[model samples]
Structure formats: C-alpha cells, structure tokens
Target: MTAVVQAEGLTKYYGRRRGLEDLTLDIQPGEIFGYLGPNGAGKTTTIRLLLDVIRPTRGRVQVLGGDPRDPAVRARIGYLPGELALEGHERARDYLRFLGRVRGGVPASRIEELAERFEADLSVQMGKLSKGNKQKVGLIQAFMHEPEFLILDEPTGGLDPLVQHEFLAMLREVRRSGRTVLMSSHVLAEVESVSDRVGIVRGGRLVAVENVAALREKAVRRMELHFDAPVPAADFEGLAGVRDVRVEGAGVRCTIDGRPDALIKAAARHTVVHMVSAEPDLEEIFLTYYSDEEQHSARQESA
Candidate 1:
C-alpha cells in the first residue's frame, strides 16, 4: 500500500537557525500516526512543510500520493492548526458553512451532526466564543468534509476530558473507514491511546519511530512506594532494571527501566502501604532512546 505521507531528507531553516533537519518518514495509509516532541522540537515545522504553508529550505514531501502544492491534492486533506484564529462577528455555524463551501460543499446536516456531538453552541459569534468552543468549531470544520487525510496539530487542546474522549472515538471511526490521520500532540496519553505507531522528534531531528506497543515495553517508569514500616534500601537498589534508588523515612523512590517484575517481587518482602507507579510518557520514552544512542556512540568511539 502506498504511504499517505512521505518525506525524504526534509529540512527547514530560518536564516542561519535550523527549524527541522533531515526528517525522513513515511506515514502509512489507514493509520493514526502520532508525532511526538517537546516545544521547539519541530513538530509544527514538519506540519507546515507537509501543508506547503512554507517552502522547505531543502527536501521534498508528498501528501496523498501527490505534491502538497497541488490544489486538488490539498482539497483531499483536512488540517487543524495548533494556533487557530477565529475573528469577526460571524456566527460559528455561518463560519463553518462558509468553510464547508470552500472545501467543496459539506451538507448542513453534517455540520449539525458534528456540532451536536461536540455539544458546541454554534449560535454564538466567533469572536465571543470561549477557547474550548472555538476549538470545537475548528474540529467541526476539519471533519465536516470528511477528507481522505487529516493533519491535526495539538488537536485536543482546550477540550474537556469528556470532549477529548469523544474526539478520540471520532479518530477511531475515521480509521475504521480506511482514512488516515497524522496527529501531533504533547499529550502522551492521547497519542498512546490511538496511535498505531509513533515518531519521536528531538532538537530538530527525527530520532526514533517505533510501534506503540514496542515502545511501551521498554519505557522508563518511576515508581514510589510508601511502607508502613521502613524497609532497607539495599533490597531495591540491587534489583534488575531499577536505578536512582532513594529511601527516605518510610518511602522509597526509584526509576525502573522496562519491566518491574523484579522490583515487585523484591518489594513483596516488606509490607506495602501506598504505591504509585508513574506510567511512561513521551519524554521518558525519548530520554530512553536518546540515552541508548549516546551509549552506542561512546562504544563506537572506544572501539
């Protein structure tokens, strides 16, 4: 199957400063590809490059099997930018109606369906709507036409927990229909929940791309346990895959790499009162991969 989005040596720069450098990636069709990165890490830069909003300093990209600059190709795409600007006195519904017409005539019923689903009050003027409400409008416009591909930047920002859940459901529905979505988000849970695969970007470079399940298997987890009675720190410090062991008073804290079976078994020796395990997130995953890369480089140098 042809990739829905492809980039080769995609690099961008602003004067002498680098925006994104040598980003090579393929987003397969009918899948939700999550783009993960911290701020100033080039997630938005890559999106703009794909949308042809700004020309790349060097490199090439294709969206939907054709050049993104092609109007016909662009028409098949739905994009929701991170910084959405809504102004003027036009009612939200009227603004959507206009956008629908621009995107080749989306039915009023379709618009209404989305509005109802998001519980968005479209009767209000665009300028008067709250941030969350404006985001709802942005989402409605992006999905109203039902394009073949969608590129969303920080798609769930400003949404309540319930609305965010509903939006993720909508993404699953889109996938079921064989459409594709590329979502760039800072929320790791959002990405981990729906993405089939995730691409990690760091410092303007494409660092690692891995299957979500595989990444989860090796993710770093920080665990804290509070015991009714203080336990010896030596028990946890020697456990495999556990590090940064610190025992203070009746609580023990440590970082565990990959599985925690060994730590759990060791901790069973003492009476456990309270235990909190921090699930690995994008930053943790990136740090793990980055550390691995550094170790490999050091080994090569020693050789």
Candidate 2:
C-alpha cells in the first residue's frame, strides 16, 4: 500500500540550532503512528514540516501521497498544534463556523456533535475559555472535518481522565473508518493505549520505530513463583532468557526477557501455588532510547 505519510532524510535546522535530523519514516494508512519525544525533541518541528507550516532546511516529505503544500492535500489533514493560540474575543462556535467556511463547509451538526462530546461550551468566548476548555475547542476543530489524516500534537493535554478516554475512543473510531493519525505526545500511557507503532525521537533525531507489540516484547518482566514444594535451582539456572535467578525455600524469582516460555515450562516441574509478575512500565522502556549511546546504537541497528 502507498504510504499515507513519508519522509526521506528529513532534517530541519534553525540557525545554529538543530530541530530534527535524518528522520526517514513511513506512516501507513489507518495506522496510529505515535511520535514520542520530550520538549525540544523536534516533535513539533516534524509536524510543522509535514503540514508545510515551515519548510524543511533539507530533505523531503509527502503527506497523503502528495506535497503538503498542495491545497488538496492540506484540506485532507486535520491538525492541532502543541501550543494552541486562542487569543480572541470571538465565541467558540463563531470561530469554528469561520474555519468551517474556509475549509469549504463542515456541517454544523458535526461541529455540534464534537462540541457535545468534548463538553465544550460553544457560547464561551475563545479568550475566556479555561485551558482545558480551550483544548476541547481545539479538539473539536480538528475532528469536526473528519479529515483523512489527523496530526495531533499533545492532543490530550489538560483533559480530564474521562474526556481523555472519550478522545481515545474517538481515535479508535477514526481508525475504524480507515483514517490515519500521527499523534505526537510525551505521555507514554496514552500512546501505549492507542498507537499501533511508535517512533521515538530524541536530541532532534529519530532513535527507533517499533510496533507496539514489538516494544512490549523487549520489556523485562520480574516474576516470582511460590511452589507447593521447593524446586531445585538446577531446573531454572540454565534456562534461556531468564536472568537474576534467586531461589529461597519454596520460591523462585527471576527477571524474564521476552516470553516466559522457558521459565514457565521450568516452573511447571513443581507444584506452583502462586505467581507474581511485575511488567516494566512503558516509560521505563522509552527511557532506554534516550541515552546518547543507546540512541547511537539504535540508529546504527536501524541502518
């Protein structure tokens, strides 16, 4: 299938400062591609380049199989910037109406529906809306058109838990309809919950891109088993992928890398009464890419 979004050697520089470097990636249709990074890590820069909000200092990008500068391509994308600027006296409804007219008419009903889902008060002036409310309005505008691709930057920022859940549900609906999403966020839980694949960016460079399942496979899990009887340490000592093994009385403890198939089979040798496993948090997995050495290693591996 043709890529919904593609970038080759994509780099951006601001004077002597780096924005992004050598970012080559492809986002497939109907996939939620989570762009993960901290502040100043170039997530916003990448989004801007994709949208043609700013021209790249080098390399090229294609959005929806065409140049993002093309009006037709731009029309097919819905974007919400990280730092939304709603400095105006116009009511929320009025602002949306004006945007709808410019976008060649988004139905009023659609706008109203999105507003209701986000619990945004359309009657409130744009300048008067609280931070969370402003974010709601931003979300409404982005989803109101129901574009083919959504570029959302820190989409769930300032949202209450319930609304965040609602927004995630909406994203699922978007994917169900065969739409694509490029969601950039530093929040790990949100991305982990919804993204099919994630690209980790650090120091203005792409470190790694992995399927969510693939990432989980790399996670280290700590497991403890309480057996009905003392199991011989010899059983688990040499098992593949099991590390840091400790045997005490009728208990066995170890960290398992990837699948616990070998460990499980080994433990079944004895009567297992109970088991406790602690999965590594996604944040812990993400931090592995942030180290300079690890980033270099990842880039080399990818190459």
Candidate 3:
C-alpha cells in the first residue's frame, strides 16, 4: 500500500540552526503513527514540512501521494496545530461553520454531533473559553470534516483526562473507518495507548521507529529480590538479559531486559522471601537509542 505520508532525507533549517536533520520515514494508511519527541525535537518542524506550511531546506516529502501545495490535497487532510490561533471575539460555532464552508460544507449534523461528543460549548466566544474548552473546539473542527488523514500536534494539550480518553476513543474509530492519523506528542503514555508504530526523535534527528509492542518488549525493569539468606553473586552472573547484578546481604538488585523467566527461575533456587520490580517509563527506553548512538560515535572517533 502507498504511504499516507512519506519523507526521504527530509532536512529543514532555520538560518544556521538545524530544525530537522535527514528524517526518513513512512506513515502507513489506517494506522496511528506517533511522532514522539521532546519540545524542540523537530516534531512540529516535520509536521509543517508535510503541510507545506514551511519548505524543507533539503529532501522531499509526499502527502497523500501528491504535492502538499495542491488545494485538493489540503482539502483531504485535517490538521490540529499544537498552538491553535483562535479569533478571540468569534463564536466557536461561527468559526467552525466558516471552516466547514471552506472544506466544501461539512454537514451541520456532523458538526453538532462532534460538539456533543466533545462536550464543547459552541455558544461561548472563543476568547472566553478555557484552555481545555478551546482544545475541544479545535478537535471538533479537525474531526467534523472527517477527512481521509489527520495531522495532530500535541492534540491532548490542555484537555481534561476524561476528554482525552474520549479523544483517543475517537481515534480508534477513525482507524476502524480506514482513515490515517499522525499524532505527535511529548507524552509517552498517550502515544503508547493509541499508536500502532512510533518514531522516536531526539535533537532534530530520527532516532528509531518500532512497533509499540516491540518497543515495550525492549523496556527495562528494575528488580530487587530479598532472600532468606545471603546469596552468592556468582549464582546470578551469566544470566541472559540481566545487567548490573549486585548482591548485598540477603538482597539482590539488578536491571532486566525483556522477559524475566531466566531470572525468576534463578531466584527460585534460593529461598525467595520478597521481590520488588519497577517498570521504567517509555522515555528511558527512548534514551537508550540516543545512548547507543553516542556510544557508536565515540567508538568511531576512537578508531
């Protein structure tokens, strides 16, 4: 299947500063592709390039199999920018109506339905709405048209937890309807909940892309085991996937990668009294990629 969005050697620069560097990626149709990065990690830069809001300094990008500059292409896409700009005095209903007309008349029923779902008050003027309410309005506009593709940047910003939950449910429905979504966020848990595949970016570079499940599999866990008696450190050594093994007076602590079957069995040999395991957050997993890259660079320099 052709990609919904594609970028090859996609680089962007603002004067002498780098915005994004050689980001090569493909987002498939009918999947929620999470673009994960920190605040200045080029997620917005990539989005703007894809939307033709800014031209890339180098490389090429294709959205919906054509140039992003084309009117028809824009019409088929829904975008909710990270920083929304709303006309302060305009009524929310009037604003959505204007956009609907621009998109060739999104049905009134559809607009009403979306508002109801998001619990958005179209009656309020844009300026008077709270940040969370404004976010709801933004979401209603982006989804009311039901375009073939959606590009959302920090979509859940300022949203209450309940509303955020509702939005994620809406995304699942979009997938079920065969539409594609590109969701960029700094929140790891949000992306992990909805994204089929995630692209991790750091320092204006694409660090890694992997299936969400696979990425979770690579997550590190800190494990501590207490034994009835002191256990020898040598007994835990040479266990596959275990690292930083330390034995300290009836207690053992180590970090484990992937499954803990071997570690569990090894611990069972001793009189296991208690165990405490803590799962690291996705950010830690993401940092491993950067760590590996740094190690590689250092090795090259040494060589």
Candidate 4:
C-alpha cells in the first residue's frame, strides 16, 4: 500500500542551527501515528516541513501521494498548528463558517456537532475566548471539513481531561473511516490509547518507530503479586526482564522490563490470589531511546 506521508533524508536548518536532520519516515494510511518528542525536538519543524510552510534544505517528501505544495493535496489536508493564533472580534462560529466556505463548504450540522462534542460555545468572539476555547475552535476547523489527512500538534493542550478524552475518541473514529492522522504530542497518555504506532524523535533526529503493541513489550512496568501463601524470592529473581524482586510474606513486588512472560510464568507456579500490574512507563521508554542516541552520538564524535 502507498504510504500517506513519506520523507527521505528530510532536513531543515535555521541559520547555523539545525531544526531537523537526515530524517526519513513513512506514515501509513488508516493509522494514528504519534510523533513523540520533547519541546524543540524537531516535532513542530517536521510538521512545518510537511506543510511546506518552510522548505527543507535537502530531501524528498510526499504527502497524500503528491507534493505538499500541490493545491489538490493541500485541499485534502486538515491542519491544527501548535500555536494557533485566533485574532479579531469575529465570533468563533463565524470564523469556522468562513473557513468552511474556504474549504468548499462543510455542513452546518457538522460544525455544530464538533462544537457540542468539545463543549465549545461558538457565540463568543474569537478575541474573548480563553486559550482552551481557542484551541477548541482550531480543532473544530481542522475536523469540520473531514479532510483526507489530519496533522495535529499538541492537540490536547489547554483541554480539560474530559474534552481530551472526547478528542481522542474522535481521532479513533477518524481512523475507523480509513483516513490518516499524524498527531504530535509529548503527552504519551493522551495518544497511547489511540495511536497505532509511534515514532520517537529526539534532538532533530528520528530515533525509532515501533508499533504500540511492540512498545508495550519493551516498556518498564511495576508489578506486584499477592499469593495465598508465601513465595520464594528466588522464584522470581534471575528471570528475564524481572528484577528488584521483593518477596515478603504473602506479598511479592518486582519490576519487569520488556516481556513479562518470565515473571508471569514464575507467578503461575504459585497460587496468585491477586495481581497488580501498573501501566508501563512509555515516556521513559522513549527517553531511553534519546539517552542511547545521545550516548552513541557522543561516542561517534569522540572517535
């Protein structure tokens, strides 16, 4: 299948500084791709490059099967910028309607439906809306047209927890319709549940890309097991990906990294009355890639 977004050796420079470097990637169709990174880690720069707002120094890029500068391709894309600027005294509803017209017209009911989902009051003037409300307006415009591809940056910012939840659910529905999304955010929890695969970018370089299910296998999870009777620490120790074992009376606590098969089998040897497996530290997993990359880069420079 043809990729929705493809880039080879994608690089961007700002004067003497590097905004992005030697990056190559592909975003598949019918999937939510989470671009994971810290601030200034080239996430926004990559987005801008794809949008053709800033030209790359050297590289090949294709968006929606054609150049991003193609008018037809641009017409098929929906974007919500990281720093959405809403100015003027225009009513939020009016602003969205104008954009809808610019997009060749979107249904009035669609606009209202998005507003209600995000609990946005469209009657208020754009200038008077708070940051969160402005973001809601931005989101509404991005989704109101139902473009073929959606590129969102920090979409959950300034959104309340409930609204964030609603936004994520909406993303799933978008994917369900066989569309594509490239969502960039530092908040892992916000996208973890919806993202099909994630690309880790650090310091302007693409570190790694993995399916969310595969990432789960590699994540560090705090695990605890309760047995009806006491178990031996030796039973859990020395198991692959199992460490920090502490078996006290009927309680067993340990840390598991990567696959938990070893630990699970060990616990199965005993009568596990109860078990508690905390959510994996996905952010830490991403950071490990950053750390390894920095170390390797440093070593290469020294060599």
Candidate 5:
C-alpha cells in the first residue's frame, strides 16, 4: 500500500530548544497510525509541520506524495489542533458551516446529521457552548469534509466517555472508507483500540513503532490462572517469551513478555477454572520510555 504520510529526518526547533528531531516514519494509506507521547513531546509540532502551519528546520515531509505546502495536498487532509480557539457569539452551526464552506462546502444535510449524532446544540453560540459542545463543533468541522488523511490532536478532549466512543467510532468509519488517520494522543487505551500501529515518541523523537498487538505483548502483563489440578511447573518453565513463572498449589502465575500462546496452551493442559490478566497503565508505560529518553538526553548533554 502507498504511504499517505511520510517523513524522513524531519526536524524542528524553537530558539535553542528542539521541537522534533530526526523524526522518521511512514503511515500507510487507510491505516490509523497512533502517535503516542506525553505533553511537550513534539506531537503538535509534527502535526503543524505536516499542515505547513510552520516550517521544518530540516529534512523532508510528503503528504499524499506531494509537498505539504501544496494547497491541493492539504485539501486531502483534515486536522484538529490540541488547543482549539473558537470565539464566542457566533452560533455553533454557523461556525461549522463557515469552516465547511472554506473547505469547499459540506452538504447542509451532512452538517445537521453530524450535529444530531454528536448531540451538539448548534443553536447555541460558540462562546456559550460548554467545553464538550465546543469539542463537538470541532469534530464536526474536522470530519465534515471527509478528507483522505486525518490528523487529530487529542481529538476527544473534554468529551465524556460516550462522546469519546462516538469520536473513535467516527474515526473507525473514516478508515473503513479507505481513508487514513493519524491520531496524536497520550490516551493509550483509546488509541490501542483503534490504531493499526502505534509510534511511541519521547523527548521530540520517535522511540518505537509497533503494531498494537505486538507492543502490548512487549509490555509484559501479569496473568494468574487457577486450575482444578496442579499444573506441571516443568511444562511451562523457561517457555519462550514466558518469564517470572511461579507455582502455588493448584494455581500457576506468570508474566508473558511478548507471547501468551505458549502459556495459554500449557494452562489448557490443566482443568482451568479462571484466569485474570492485567495490562500496565499509561503511567507505567510512560515511565519505561521516559526514563530511557532521560538517560539518553543526559548522555547527549554531557557529550
């Protein structure tokens, strides 16, 4: 499949500080690429560079096989900023209509359909709308055009769980239509559900890019299994990608690093009553990369 977005050695700076450095990646067409990182980690910077909102200090970026500065290339892309700036007094419907018109006139019916689906009160002025309502407006505009490539920065911010699910469903729909989505978010679980592949960024650089299933596997999760009969400790001992195995009476417990199949099949050998698996939270995942980046940064600073 052709790449919808490709960046190589993409670098940016703000004064003496780095914004994004040596960033390189390819987002396949019709794929949802999750850009995972904490705040000030250059997620926004990368988006801005892609949109041509700012210039890259170095390297190259191609959107839709053309320069991002090309208006035609930009027309095929949709974007929502991390910080949404909407003025008050203008009704939400009017606000969205204006954006739609600027983007070549989205159908009136389409606009109304999205408004109702998101439960947004378009009659209210943008300024009077609650934070969630304002977000709904943003979503409507970003998605109304149905661009080929979507770059959403914290797209579901300020929205409730239901609204967030709605937004993700919309994203999934976009991908279903064979469009591409690049979602930049720190919300790991949400992204995990929708992303085909996730790129973990830290300190203005891409650290790891792996398929969701693969990444989750790399991050070992603890699992406890209870069986009717005692499991042969030897059956699971030192199994490939299995670690920290312990036997306690009729139960067996272990942490599977990158493969659970082996452990599962072994457990199935016994009469299994129940099993519990707990994946690490974002904080735990964050510290894993953050600390590594911190050490790398420190070494670079010293050098």
Candidate 6:
C-alpha cells in the first residue's frame, strides 16, 4: 500500500536558520505514527510541508498519493496546526461553522457532535476563550471533517488531564475505523500509550523509528533492591540483560534491558527485604540522539 505520507530529502530554511534538514520519512496507512521532538526541533516545519502550507526548500512530499498542494488531495486530509490563531469577536461555534462550510458544506451535526465529545462550550468568544478551550475548538474542526488522514501537531498542548484522556480515546476511535493519524507530541507517556510506532527527530533529522513493542524491549527498566543484609557480589554477577550495577550497604541497583526475569531471579536468591522497579524510560532513545549530537559538536570544537 502507498504510504499516507512520504517525503524524500525534505528540507526547510528560514533565511540563515535551518528549520529542517534533509529529512526523509514515511507513515504507513492505518498506523498511528508519533512524531517527537523538543521545541525548535522542526516538528511543526515537517507538518507544514506535509500539508503544503509551505513548500520545502528541496526534496519532494506526497500526501494521500498526490501532491499535497492539490486541493482535491487536501479534502481527504485533516490537519491541526501547532500554533492556533483566531481573531477577536468571533464565537467558537460560528468559527467552526465557517470552516465546515469551507470544507465543502460539512454538516453542522458533525460539528455539534465533536463539540459535545470534546466538552467544548461553543458560545464563548474566540479571543476570550482560555487556551484550553481554544485548543478544543481547533480539535473539533480537525475531527469534524472525518477525513481519511489526520495530522495533529502538539494536539494536547493546552488540554487539562481529563480532556487529554478523552482526546486520546477519540484518537483510538479514529484508528478503529481504519483511518490514519499522525500525532506530534513531546509527551512520551501520552504518545507511547496511543501510538503504534514512533519516529524520533532531533536537529531536524530522523534518528529512529520503532514499534512500541520493540521500543519497550530495548527499554532499560531500573530496579532497586534492599536485602536484609549485604548480598554476595557473586550472587548478582552474570545476570542476563543487566548492567550498570551499583551496590551499597544492604542495597543494590541496576538497569535491566530486555526481559526482567533474569534480574528478578537473581534478586530472589538473596534475603530480600524490599524491592522497587520502575517502568523503562521511553524518552531514553531520544536522549541518546541528543547526547550523540552533543559529543559530535564537542569533538568539532576541540579540533
């Protein structure tokens, strides 16, 4: 199947500053792909290129099997921009109504349905709405069309916890219908929960793409154990998939990658008084890229 979104050597620049640099990626149809990065890492720039809001400086982009600039192709896609801007004096409902009409006379019922689903109060003025409410309006507009492909950037930026959870459930519903979603977020836990696969971008380049399950497999689970007495050093030695062991008085800590069975078995051999294990840090993969970049820059400066 053709990818929902495809780009080759995608690049963007704002005069002297590089917004994106020679990025290439593909998002499979019906997959919820998460795009993750920190501020100014070109997440928004990539989204704009996909939506044809701005042309790339080099390389090609295809969305929904056609050029992103084609009006017919855009109709089949829904996009929520990273920065949402609405002028003063317009009620939220009226604004969504205008968008609905622009998108080929979409039914008002769809708009109302989304408003209720998001728990958005549409009577409020656009300028007066709180940041969270404004974000809700943006989300409603994006989902109201019910397009085949949905691309959302920093979608939960201003949402409260409760609303954020509701939004995630709606995304799951979207996926259940076999539609595609590309969600860009910096929040690891949120993205990890909903995404089938994730692409980590740093310094305007794609670093890694992995399925959620595979990522978890490589994740390092931290465990700390307190024994009634100091355990023998040989007891924990040669444990499979365990590393970075540090043992203090009556306590031991280690990072276990892959399965935790070996580590658990090793700990069980001792007189265990207390034990704690933390879920793997999903963001560690992204941090690896940052660290590599820093080291490379340091080498260049030293030279």
Residue 152 lDDT in candidate 5: 91
Candidate 4 residues lying further than 4 Å off, grouped into runs, are: 232-241
| Every model's TM-score | 0.79, 0.93, 0.84, 0.93, 0.91, 0.88
Query: Which prediction has more favorable lDDT, 3 or 6?
Result: 3
Ranking by TM-score: 2, 4, 5, 6, 3, 1
What are the per-residue Cα lDDT tens digits for candidate 2 across 101-141? 88889999999999889888999999899999999999998
lDDT per residue (tens digit) for residues 1-303 in model 1? 889998999999999889999989999999899998888899999999999998999988988999999988989999999999999999999999998898889999999999999999999999999999999999999999999999999999999998998899999999999999999986577788899998888779878898897777788889999889988877877889988999997899999888999989988998999999987785566667778877987899999
Which residue runs does candidate 5 get wrong by more than 4 Å?
280-286, 297-303
| Per-residue accuracy of model 5 over 1-303 as CA lDDT, tens digit each | 668888999999998899999999999998999998889999999999999999999999999899999998888888888888887798888888888888888998999999888998899987788888888888888888999999999887899988888888898899899999999988677688899998888779899887876666677678899988776789889787788999988888888876688888878778899999886454466567678878988999999
Model 4 lDDT per residue over 1-303, tens place:
889999999999998799999999999889899998889999999999999899999898999999998877888899999999998899999999999998899989999999999999999989899999999999999999999899999999999989988898899899989999999998777778889999888889888998998889878899999999988877877898888889899899989878889888888999989999998877777777778888999999999
The predictions' CA RMSDs to the true structure, in order, are 4.6, 2.9, 3.1, 1.9, 2.2, 2.6
Tens-place lDDT per residue, model 3, 106-150, is: 888888899888889998998898888889989998998899999
lDDT of model number 6: 0.88
CA shift of 260, model 1, Å? 8.8
Report lDDT (Cα) of residue 220, candidate 2. Answer: 90
Q: Please give the CA lDDT of all the candidate structures.
A: 0.90, 0.91, 0.91, 0.91, 0.86, 0.88
- Spell out the clash pairs found in candidate 3: none
Candidate 2 lowest-lDDT run of ten: 288-297
Model 3 alpha-carbon drift over 4 Å, by segment: 224-239, 242-254, 263-277, 294-303
RMSD of candidate 4 to true structure, Å: 1.9
Give candidate 2's error at residue 281 in angstroms.
2.1
lDDT of 3: 0.91
Q: Count clashes in each candidate, considering only residues at least 3 apart in sequence or on different chains.
A: 0, 0, 0, 0, 0, 0
* Total colliding residue pairs, candidate 1: 0
